[model samples]
Target: MASNAQRRDVTRERILKAAARLLSEEGPSAVTTRRVAHEAGLQPPALYRLFQDKDDLLDATAEHVFAGHLANKLTTAPSDDPVEDLRAGWNLQIGFGLANPYVFGLLLDPARARDTPGQAKGLLILAERVHRIAAAGRLRVSEERAINLIHSAGIGTVHTLLALPPERSDPHLADAAFEAIARAVLTDEPAAPAQDPAAVIASFRSLLPDLPNLTEAEAALLDEWLQR
Candidate 1:
């Protein structure tokens, strides 16, 4: 017989794993209580015993996705240089996005976000981080402005990449594009000369590790400079 701790752990894992799988395949709508219970080898009645309801389950999944990310205990690596620290944080965010596109999608969905305070709170937390950095006068743009800029650009890039056919999509390319735009906007001016648009983009591509799935031609296309 499993200990109480072990039983609880097993149940939580079963729920989370089922939710993740359903979310990945069908977005949020696919994650009904019945579906999750089916996926987890639990009866619908048993699933209710585990969670309050479908909304509660969805809330838990949202929280699980953002746990280490935008929560109160945000994961910012210490850096003597503030600019570098901010850049690293941004990279970490992009990494999170790549690692969990489904959760990322849910977080960005306006309809679902309205129903989940956890997702809204996560954004507020991220905004506060930007606010703090801006208050130090260390940013090129105001904190709120900076956050809006980055947030809009990041969401746009992700959405566009996701919409493309798999043959046309390259996550590495998307990452590179975001990095370039981020560097252009975030780099301090006095220490750095005017950013060369081409150089900013090149820097983005340079940061990408080699990808196994990307074809030479597709990779080349992804690497091409953005049009004016």
Candidate 2:
């Protein structure tokens, strides 16, 4: 027999699955306590035991649906080329959003994003990718700026594609958008030449903490000079 904790886990999974179905098929407004309980074969009061309220239930449902996508993202091994790896991640992100627009919208909603743990994890993954590029002396911008640009561009690409009438949709928009962001944030060549010394400085700044024999204040001052 299932233990009490095991039974609760099973019950939670059933509720989340039902809620996710309603969200995907009928949208957020349809995921009420009554409807979800019916769909999950439980009474309305059962959900209260597992979740605080309707909003809490909705947040958990979103997290449940995104779990698989996040796992897939985690499985991508880093390649020899960081640029190629980033582009792969970008393509995967766009594909995931296009394939799961309902989940994407729920995750994107600022109001509903009140309890988003997945987004934070995804940002950490992106930061690691950007850090790799900076360490390679290929990024001409700060890591924060580069991460923001890539993240914004991806979100915009998904929104653009989804907003289009099917006949007007251009599949190449994602590739073009990524290339534009790349051009804005990355140098034409690695360890950018004298004409673009910022990339080199950015590269050094990435290793600031690893440099030997530098006091905290001295490192901070050097970083300020490098940013200039």
Candidate 3:
């Protein structure tokens, strides 16, 4: 015998799957309560019990999309070159936005946007990649700045590409955007003062924690310079 809770769980999954399909095929405007319920073969009232409102439903559907994206991102093993790994992540994110425009649109809505486990995990993955670059003395900017620059540039690239017609889209914009950001955040050589003075400071900052004979406060002061 199926318990009520188990039945509800199954029903919820069915509803979300239908909603996702609707969003993907028909576009964001088609994902209404009536349409979702019809696609799910459930009463509209039943959806109310699961999702508070339309915005809630949209957010959940976006989460469903991100869940899969995050899983795919995790399965790809990291490469030896952290910079290359970061570029790979950028490609993955750009692909996701282009492939799932409906989900991307819903997530862009300020009223519908909120933090999700999937987004948190994605940020953590980005941060780790940036950290690796910094640790390797290849980063000319702070890890946080580099991460933010990559994230902002990626968002802008996706938005700009999506706004144009398919035939009108510039296929090379993504590559160009990444290269521009790389120039701003990275150096050609690793930790060479002549090549990049800030990179040397950043490289030295990597050793701040391990330097012996420093008091806790002194170490704190030097670590603050890493932000530059």
Candidate 4:
């Protein structure tokens, strides 16, 4: 017989997988513990033992999808140009967003984003990249403004893509729009070099003292996205 820990692990995996499948098939409202258990071939109580509620399962599923997306972006290819790296990262993000629109939709939802740890990690990643750019002294605009603009554009792309009518859901059009936005934010001219994520974040941090108007949840959401 499986030990309690093993059973717990199995249940967790089952719930997450079920949530992801349902999230992809149905929308967010379709994800419930009972539905997940039915999908996983487990009793409803088994799911409750593993996750507190639907929100818990949704969070785990989002993290699982995000980790998969990040794994595809590890690059060994180095360029002396910082803008090139920034372009790579931006394009990668857009590609992932379009590829996993359902999971991406979860991240964009402000209500579901409360109490998420991934939010902070996303900011760290962005800060790391910004720091890299600052070290190269290639920033054409204030780092904070630049980071905010790029970050907002990247996020806005997801919303824009989601808003498109089914008939107009063209991935090629999405990719082209993404490239134009990335070019405008990350480079002063075409063929400019890639920047480091770290330097860009640090420079932005130095300019902003505090998020004055942002509510806790709003601030949390921003940090979560930036960390990623």
Tell me the TM-score of each prediction against the true structure. Answer: 0.59, 0.90, 0.87, 0.68
lDDT of 1 by residue, 1-228 (tens): 999888877887788788877876777898898889889998788677678988778767766767745653465545555555555655666667766777887677776665456556656755655544443334454444566777777677667766789788775765576567556555443222254443344334433336568788876677553221
Pitting candidate 2 against candidate 3, the one with the higher TM-score is 2
- The models' CA-based lDDT, in order, is 0.64, 0.90, 0.87, 0.68
lDDT of 4 by residue, 37-129 (tens): 899998999877777888878878888777666555544354677666776777778777877887887777777766455645555555556
How far is 190's C-alpha from truth in model 2 (Å)?
Answer: 1.1
Lowest-scoring 10 consecutive residues by lDDT in candidate 4?
185-194
lDDT, candidate 2, equals 0.90
Q: List the residue pairs that clash in candidate 2.
A: none
Which has the higher lDDT value, candidate number 1 or candidate number 4? 4
User: Top TM-score: which candidate number?
Assistant: 2
The prediction achieving the highest lDDT against the true structure is 2
Q: Which of the two, 1 or 4, has more TM-score?
A: 4
Tens digits of per-residue lDDT for model 2 on 115-214?
A: 4678888898899999899999999999889999999999999999999999999989999999999999998768746766889887888999899999
- Model 3 lDDT per residue over 1-228, tens place: 999999999998999999999999998788899999999999999999999988788899899888889999999998899899989999999999999988887777777667888778888999888877877778888777888999888888999999999789999999999999989988876876677777877767766778999998999987886564
Preferred candidate (lDDT higher): 3 or 4: 3
- Arranged by TM-score, best first: 2, 3, 4, 1
Residue 41 in candidate 2, Cα distance off native in Å: 2.9
Using lDDT, rank the candidates from best to worst.
2, 3, 4, 1
